[model samples]
Target: MAKIEMKNPIAELDGDEMTRVLWAVIKEKLLEPFVDLKTEYYDLGLKSRDDSDDKITYAAAEAIKRLHVGVKCATITSNEARVKEYNLKQLTRSPNGIIREELDGTVFRAPIFVNNIQCCVTSWKKPIVLGRHAYGDVYKNCEIKVPGAGKAELVFTAEDGTEIRKTIQMMKGPGILQGIHNMDKSIESFARCCFNYALDQKISVWLGTKDTISKTYDGNFKTIFQKIFDEEFKAKFDAAGIEYFYTLIDDCVARIMKHEGGILWACKNYDGDVMSDMIASACGSLAMMTSVLVSPDGNFEYEASHGTVQKHYYRYLKGEKTSTNPVATIFAWTGALAKRGELDGTPELVDFAKKLEKATLDVIEEGTMTGDLARLANPPAKQVLDSWAFIDAIAAKLK
Candidate 1:
């Protein structure tokens, strides 16, 4: 049978191990049956990444920029252990780091609900989407240790030779100094991405920052989000029946823990760092979460939230069956493909994407899943399917 014409082309990034195997099966069983997909394929496997000196990662990011959609598999993030295992130079940053920098997009994580895993927040009937600024704060702070402190000053030098410096006194004999910053332009981009995502999803947007404490720094985020909302998104939001709300970080976090999840909460860099972990633990498996990068200009890239199941894949290579959850990785493909279809006005491709999501969720609801979620299973139900078993089931359901 001739493959159906895909609505638009999407960049495909293949990764390592069990997920890498699952990636091919998903394509063969689900995507190939329905669409004549044009994918700009890039190998992001650890071996290939090392072989190409990691140029393939940069090329993949560039391809996604050009094509505007990319579906990535779970890839190994290099650590000291990984470095020894792969025999590489000092542990290089993750391939995701390279792509994240190149694309300059915001990472938003949303949970997949299954009947088996218990959520921390019982009221979360809908998804609590987190849009993390991801630019500065602790992730890029400049720190120095004071042998014997005198004074610490944060100095900002303007391009026209103007300077503004604030001196913070050290009360103790030995102290630590930290100077952190966030550019107005970066925060502006973050605001735009969050606001756009909220509007696009037809969901409410909430800005949370330490505005009361970091009056100047966090308040800038507050001001910018408010200004942008009023100037840009307010009218559109009102028309769509969504509200843009701003709350102090302390209040927001406390409230979010109790509230039913539906709003798109935008956090500063540090808040995002902490909250993502909290949300991940709450929602169940990190393997079940899907991440997407939404740029200020509305460019989208999707990927699994977890790293390559390297350890598990290695066992599988030795002829041992492994049960690596492929749901998040699968969603990455459907998410990118669906968005590409939506962007290109291909309703059929979009429909297929939505249905594919339903099919995967249906399998889980039917009680068949991989190790990550299976462990979380209330009673390790009778319908549990191994990795390949689950994949075949989803494909059959899709048909």
Candidate 2:
């Protein structure tokens, strides 16, 4: 069969560890044989980032801006241990963070639900997509560790030589102080992105923030979302039979547990960061979660919500067979391809993407899965395949 032709290239951001190993296999067995794949490839491996002084990361982000679609493998976010292990010159920042900042995108994470895999939350019959604002707040903060007792103040200086200051705290001994901020532009971008995505998915948008306490900070977020929805999205939302719901973060959490899924929960930086993980685990393993970074302008970068399988990679190095799930990674490619197909008027490509995803879920439904999923499968898989074998299984089922 002739390969499906692609009109535009996808920005492929390659990574490290076991996912990278599966990346090559997936392309060879599943993608290359069926599609004339064109990708603006960027090796985002740790060494590559260190070698290029992280220029490759920025370059990849730029290419995605031009191409408008990216599919990324899980990469390492350098830490103290990783710094020493990789022997890097400096602690490299998270590639996802860099791309999100460059594109000013909101990260949306949703689970890949399969019939055989039981969700810990038994009431969740549908998927709940978590839209996380990926900028500002505690993720980017200034902190000071006070050495001794002193008065701490929050000061603001205007360009017109006006200064306003207020006491933050009076410490009796050593303490800590932190200052965090969010830009109005970024917050507005986040609101628009969530609303746009909700409209695209035809799902309700539920925004949660602690505006009752942080009146100035969280209140701004609530205000911006309400303003945008009322002015820009309310008509569209009502026309589509969808609703925009806002409540305190605590109430949101309580409601989420009791409510059936199928809504997009828009959260602040810290809340989203924590809630996404909780939702992922409650629905299934992190390996079953698919993530996409959607910019307000409609550009997208898809990826797995999990990290590089470093432990599995180490075992593989020791000649051990490891059963690491590749479902999310495969879905990442399919998602980007589907979007590429939709934009480029290639329905066959979109069909192939749909088939690929169905094949993956079909494999799981057949009681053949990786270790993580096998444990949760209603009837445990008789035999769990390793990462490569699992990909081969899905390939055989791709039809």
- lDDT winner: 2
How do the residues 247-305 of candidate 2 rate in per-residue lDDT, one tens digit apiece?
A: 99999999999888999999998898889889888876888888999998879999988
Over the full model, what C-alpha lDDT does candidate 2 score relative to the true structure?
0.92
Report, for every candidate in turn, its global Cα lDDT versus the true structure. Answer: 0.81, 0.92
lDDT of 1 by residue, 1-399 (tens): 665577557888999877888888888887888788889899998878887888899999898888888889878877778788888755555677677667777889888888777787777777888888857676556788888848777788999999998878754678788878778888888888988888889999888888788899889999988888889988999999999988888889889988898988888866875787678768877767778987765677898877677788788889987777888888898898889888998887889889999999888877777767776777565566667888889988988
Which ten-residue region of model 2 has the weakest summed lDDT?
Answer: 374-383
Model 1 regions lying over 4 Å from their true place: 47-54, 115-118, 138-157, 160-180, 378-380
RMSD of 1: 3.1
TM-score of 1: 0.86
**lDDT accuracy of residue 53 in candidate 1:** 84
